[model samples]
Target: MIVSITGATGFIGRRLVQKLAEGDHEVRVLTRSKENAKLLFPVEKFPKITIAGEFEWKDCIQGSTAVVNLAGMPISTRWSSEVKKEIKDSRTRVTSKVVDLINGTSYDTRPSVLISATAIGYYGTSETKVFDERSPSGNDYLSEVCRVWEAKALGVDKDVRLALIRIGVVLGKEGGALAKMIPFFMMFAGGPLGSGNQWFSWIHLDDLVNLILEALKNPSYKGVINGTAPNPVKLTEMCEKLGEVTGRPSWLPVPDFALKAMLGEGATIVLDGQKVLPLKAQELGFSFKYPYVRDALKAIISL
Candidate 1:
């Protein structure tokens, strides 16, 4: 199968591309820098893969069996009005472009599956609620971003299988939120952010990549699916587990006020969270390698 992927250089996208290549599938990565993509995924190793710039999306997506749309700006920053517009435009505009391309293509020529990325932020921050794919969407800033992003992807023709993978806080050693937090924990300054009571719905990077693979192969696995582990942990418990995994102290906590001052509205990403479960993924027989926070933390921190 030939797979066309946007945001192919992102943290999750990189691993996903490698996995597809390892499975002996042809990959066309839609990137702004073909040179950089080649450096990361060498031609000798990933000979089946090719990298092309955004202007070449038509060529990159042509004859593809699957199109994984992961293009979007990183949301972890001070949310100035300008940054907010960038965030919204980054997701909505790219998705609209892909949907238009897919819609314009002939039914037989178009990709069969469109596996797009969304997030648990669609559910909003709620300590008491356990959200599944069927849960109603929240009206927060992140939620609005996810809502519009998924909306555009869903606009693809009915002939295509659309898998909206609502990702959670991905735990891995290489990149993502864990990479940013591990350094502080290793230095013994790590602790819970904000009140530490917020529920954290997270998944191991390995599990997430596997879930994507499953979506690609399963025709019936369409619609929304949470890319989270079965178990959700409180922020405080997560910090404690990370501390244990690294053999460091989890005593020093960052106050909510301090985080708000530093990150502005972006602090909500760390200070607030949701209790999300991969109900649909599990129902579709997708098992997670790391379902618990302790085991996930140990695996990531050990690396």
Candidate 2:
């Protein structure tokens, strides 16, 4: 099978690309920087990987089994007017181009499916609400971004199956929420980010990749699927688990005001969170290797 991926240099995209290469499928990494993609996936190790730039992106997607769209600006920093515009445009604009490419393809050359990335932030942050794929989109900046992002993906041809993965916080060894939090724990200054009561809906990176693979292969994997572990936990609980695994104390607490001051509006991502669950994945008979927060933490720390 041929798979074309955008955002191939990102945290999730890099792992997804590696997994696809391991499966021995032809992988085309569509990036603005073919040079960077080549750096990440050298011919020496990833012999089956092809690097594609904007000029070749259309050709790479033609007749491809799947086009996995994961490109976007990272939402893990402070927000200014310019930065907010960047975050929104980075997703919606890219998605528009992908849709145009897919829709413009000849009937026989169109991709079979389009697996696009969204975020659990679509549900917005609420200390009390538990979100599933069926929930309505929230009325925040991130939620609006997600809504527009998915709408753009929905423009794909009627024959092409579309799976919008509304991802949660991904826990991994190299980079992600875990990477940011681990250092604090190692220094015995780690604890919950804000109130310690916000939900930390998360998935192990491997589980997330597996879910994407399932979506790629299974016809049943259409529409919105929450890419989160079955079990969600409060930030405080997640901190406790991290403390246990790393043999560090969960004592220091980051004040909510501090997070807000630092991240500006972006602080809502961590200071307030939604309890998102992978209900669609469950209905589709998907299983997670690390369902619990502690187990997920153990697996990550062991790595």
Candidate 3:
């Protein structure tokens, strides 16, 4: 199978590309810089590198069995009005381009599946709610972005199967929310972001990539699937687990106002969270390698 990926240099996307390449699939990546692409997967290690520019999807997507769209602006920083526009455009615009390419391609040559990225933030910052793929979207900055992003993916022609992975916080050794918090934990300054009650739905990086591969290979894996662990843990529990794994203290606290002041509206990315569960994936016979927070943290920290 030929797999074409956007945002191929990103944390998860690059790893997905490497995995697909190792699976003996033809992997093509859409990147802005050939130099950066080489840096991501050295030519010596990954001998076959098919590089395409941001607008060159039409050229690169030919003969692809799947096209995975993971391009977007990071929502981890302060969200000024300008930055918000960038956050919205970075997702919607790129998705629009991908849709256009799929629509324009000839029937026999177009990719069969579109596995686009969404976030668990679609459920919003609900401390009390248990969200699944069937839940209605929440009214928040990130939720709105996710709604539009999924809508664009759904607009594709009926011939293409669309799988919108509503992703949660991914726990991994390389990079992600865990990478940002590891230093603080190592220094014994790590704790829950705000009120420790809020739920932190997360998935192991390997599980997330495997979910995408499942969507790519299985025709029945269509529509929205929550990309989160089955057992969601409270923020405090997550912190405590991290501390246990690293032999550090998880007693410190970060005030909500301080996070708000530092990150503006973007603070909600950490300050608030959703209790998301992967019901669809489970019903479709998917199993997670790290279903518990303690096990997930231990694996990541040891790496």
On lDDT, the candidate that comes out on top is 2
The list of candidate 3 runs beyond 4 A from truth reads none
Clashes (candidate 3):
0
Task: Evaluate model 3: give its TM-score.
Answer: 0.97
Candidate 2 clashing pairs, residues 3+ apart or interchain: none
Give per-residue CA lDDT, model 3, range 1-303, as digits (tens).
888888889889988998998988888888767789878878787776688776676888877888999988888889999999999999998888888888889999999999999999888888888899999999988889999988898889999999999999988888888998899888889888899888899999999999999999999899999999999999999999999999999999878998889889888888888899899999999988889989988888887
All candidates in order of lDDT, best leading: 2, 1, 3
**What's the TM-score of each model vs. the native?**
0.97, 0.98, 0.97
Residues 25-65 of candidate 1 have per-residue lDDT tens digits of 99999887888898998988888888888798986676789
Worst 10 residues of 3 by lDDT: 48-57
Query: Model-by-model lDDT, in order?
Result: 0.89, 0.92, 0.89
lDDT for each residue of candidate 2 in 52-126, tens digit (9 for 90 to 100):
899999999887888999999999889999999999999998899999999999988889999999999899889
Clashes of each: 0, 0, 0
> Candidate 1 — what's its lDDT?
0.89
